[model samples]
Target: MAMALETLSSPIILFFALGLLAALARSEMTVPEAFAKGLAIYLMMAIGLKGGVEMAANPLTGEVIRAFGAGIVLSFALPLVAFAALRLTSGIDRVDAAASAAHYGSISIVTFVAATEVVQATGLMPGGHLVAVAAVMETPAIITALLLARQANAAGGPVAGSERGELLREVMLNASVVVLVGALIVGWIIGPEGFEPTKPFFVAPFQGVLCLFLLDMGLSAGRGLRQGWRQLDVGAITFGLYMPLISAAVAAALCWVLALAPGDSALLITLAASASYIAVPAAMRLALPKAKPAIYLTLSLGVTFPFNLTFGIPLYTAMGQWVGS
Candidate 1:
């Protein structure tokens, strides 16, 4: 309860709420798209660098290896679970369900970033390698979702004018993956001493930047919900709200099995609970052109993202602490 209150009261979350409220009220307030994109890139780069520096300081222990394996397993497996749940509970077709399921399997970098802050505030520092784990987790769900689409014969053939290897290139070289992984490697190479010179830029103002980015996100989410809510039925909307809890439960069990620390466990739980809006949408466009972005994107960005940001992070934090304890 205290944790939840604290999270809700935090500046970043509040800023997000403000944006959401503004958008829902039909305010014409907007963040410049180019600036918003820059913010996103900056946030990713900062997180990636920080993770790499921490990883550079530590040896790759057996536990870390196990964590990586667990992340991959969750990434691949959660989408299957999500697809089943969505198909059974909602009126969405196989392709749309598959597309939406892919989102639940992948990590949301912003949500992960928020959870990292909360976990750290709880005095548990998650490992930096989780960033790499995050990067690793991005694409596997994509593969699974594509396979699901193919099985339903919904994919049919490549979209006209789509080049060979285009999906491969998009999946592999997507902005999120590329910036995150590249920044991690760079940070690893530099280590702490090398990172020190740039601390002012990367570390000091991180929270403020995050608040700004999230405000834009809140606007985006609200706008998406406003525009796309009609496309989502009661069952689909309900799925958006409840599915994270299911994913969190699965991750909590894995955390117990892995004997992870509270901080790392919380992070893993949050990652598992999060649904991707950015990368998956783009991939689905190329791969499953028939799948409605209105459905998947709204569910992910509109319903799930806000829930995770406000209530879910706190719940996952407590769950992580309990499991690790």
Candidate 2:
């Protein structure tokens, strides 16, 4: 309860709430798109570097390998569950359901970042390798989604003017993956001693930058909800709200099996629970061109993201503490 209150009242979450409320109220306040993109890049780079530095301090071990395996398995398998749930519960067509399922299976970097902050604030430090785990988890769900679409014969023909290998390029070379993996490698190469001089830029300002970025995210979510909510039926909307919990429960069971510590457990659970708004959506645009962006984007950014930020983090944290203890 205390953790939940703290999370809700944190400066970053509050800034997010402010932006969400502003947008929901139809306020015209806006962050420049270019600037928001810049913010995203900076956040990704900082996190990657930190994770890399941590990896440099520790050697890869069996536990780390297991965590990676678990992440990949989750990435590959969760969409099947999500797809099944959507098909069984909602009237959505296979293409849209598959696309939306992909989003649920993928990790949201921002949500992972937010969870890192909360976990650390509670004096539990997650492993740096989890960052690499996050990067690895982004693309497999996309593959699963495409396969699901293909199986249902819902993939249809490719979009006109689409060149072969375009989807592959987009999935592999997307900005999020490239920046994150690249930055992690750079940080690993430099190590802690080399990172000292750069702390002024990447370390000190990280929190404030995240607050600003999340405020923009809040605005985006609010606008998406306002504009797209009507497109969702009760079943679809409820899926957005409940799916994360289901994902988190699955992750927690995995953490127990793996015997992960509290901090790492919290982060992994949070990663499992988060849905991608950036990478998967862009890929879905190419691979499943027939899928409606409004459904997936709105569910991810509007309903799931807000729920995770305000309430889900605290609950996941407690679950982590329980399982780890």
Candidate 3:
């Protein structure tokens, strides 16, 4: 309860809430699209660099290898579970369900960033390899979702005008994946001493920058909900709310089996719980054009993102503490 209150009142979250509220109230305020894009790049670069530096400080242990493998397995497997649930519980068609399933299997970078803040505040530093794990986890569910959609008689092959390699390009070279993985490698090469020169720009200002980014995210989410909510049925909306908890439970069990530390476990749980709004949406546009963005995007960005930001983080934190203890 205390953790939840603290998180809700934090400047980062409060700013997000402010944006959400303003948007819901139908205010005219807007963040410049280009500038918001820049903010996203900056945040991703900062965290990628930080994670790389930490990873450089330590050799990759067997446990780290196991965590990486676990993450991949989860990424590939979760969509199957999500697809089944969505098909059974919601009125959405196979393509939409498959598209939505891909999102559930994927991780949200912004949510991971937010969870990192909470983890850091609690003085439990998560491993850098998790960033690598996050990078690895980005695309497999995409493949799975495509397969599921095909199997269910949803459109097969590329959408008209999509090149043979377009889906590959979308998955591999997407802004978040490229910037994150590239920055991580750069940071790994630079090491701590080399990163020191950029500390003022990258490290000290990170939290404030994050606050600004979250505010924009909140606005995006709120606006998406306002415009797209009608596309989501009650069951679909409920799935968005509950699926994260389901994923978190699955991750918690894996964390316990793998014997991860509380900090690491919490991060993994959060990643598993988060739904992809950015990466999956782009892929869906190219691959499953028939799939309604209004359904998947609103559910992910509006319902799931806010829930994870507000309540899921605290619950996952407690789960981590319990499992680690």
Q: In terms of TM-score, how similar is model 2 to the real structure?
A: 0.99
lDDT winner between candidates 1 and 2: 1
- Runs of candidate 1 with Cα error greater than 4 angstroms are none
How high a TM-score does candidate 1 get?
0.99
Give per-model TM-scores: 0.99, 0.99, 0.98
On residues 1-325, what C-alpha lDDT tens digit does candidate 3 reach at each position?
9889999999989999999999999988899999999999999999899889989998999778878887888899999989999989989999999999999999999889888888878888789888988888899989999999999578675556767888899999999999999999998999999999999999999999999999999899989999999999899999999999999999999989998888888988999999999999999889888999999999899999999999999899888877863
Question: How high is the CA lDDT of each candidate model?
Answer: 0.95, 0.94, 0.91
Give the clashing pairs for model 1: none
lDDT of 3 at 143: 91
Ordered list by TM-score, greatest first = 1, 2, 3
- Give the alpha carbon lDDT tens digit for every residue of 1-325 in model 2: 9999999999999999999999999999999999999999999999999999999999998878988988998999889989998888888899999999999999999999999999999999889999999999999999999999999689987778999999999999999999999999999999999899999999999999999999999999999999999888889989988999999999999989998889888998999999999999999999998899999999899999999999999999888888873
Q: Candidate 2 has which clashing residue pairs, if any? A: none
Clashes of each: 0, 0, 0
Compare the candidates by lDDT and give the number of the best one: 1
